[model samples]
Target: MIQKQLYFNNNMRQLIKSCKLGRDWKKNRNFHSYKAVQEDAKILVQPMHDSETRELSFKKNSNVLIQDGLLRFHSKDIKNNF
Candidate 1:
């Protein structure tokens, strides 16, 4: 009985370690916004088009939305510019 319990404990520890590592890896691999503005628990993003880079800039109070397991940015400025 003691040996069985030890085996179960070891399996559980390994499972927990693997889960933690997977979560950490996912967090590190994901893209995160640089800054955000929030009001009443709502997020507002202000993105600008970088003329040199030809990509959306997220350096200025840019917030992101995560939908369908993807990061999305929504703004009239972004739509009009791009």
Candidate 2:
């Protein structure tokens, strides 16, 4: 898949930074391992929501934050965005 330029929050930015700092934090390729969020000039991620289901991906540029293994995407009309 192709990845585009994106941003994230401070919390996520720190997470990515720490992951690179050592082997304590590992990266997930499928995007279901962790939650994701998007902000301006934050970090690289892919959390865009599904156009039909509105269910968001936990990918790097995703916006779904995991709250106890739950995927949450706040979108009224996800199709419009897609």
Residues 26-55 of candidate 1: C-alpha lDDT, one tens digit per residue: 222244422333221222222222112222
Work out the TM-score per prediction.
Answer: 0.23, 0.20
Candidate achieving the largest lDDT: 2
lDDT of 1 at 49: 23
49 Cα displacement, candidate 2 (Å): 22
- Model 1 lowest lDDT segment of ten: 13-22
Per-residue CA lDDT of model 2 for 1-82, tens digit only, reads 2122233432231111111111122334545442233222122223333122221123333343333323233442112232
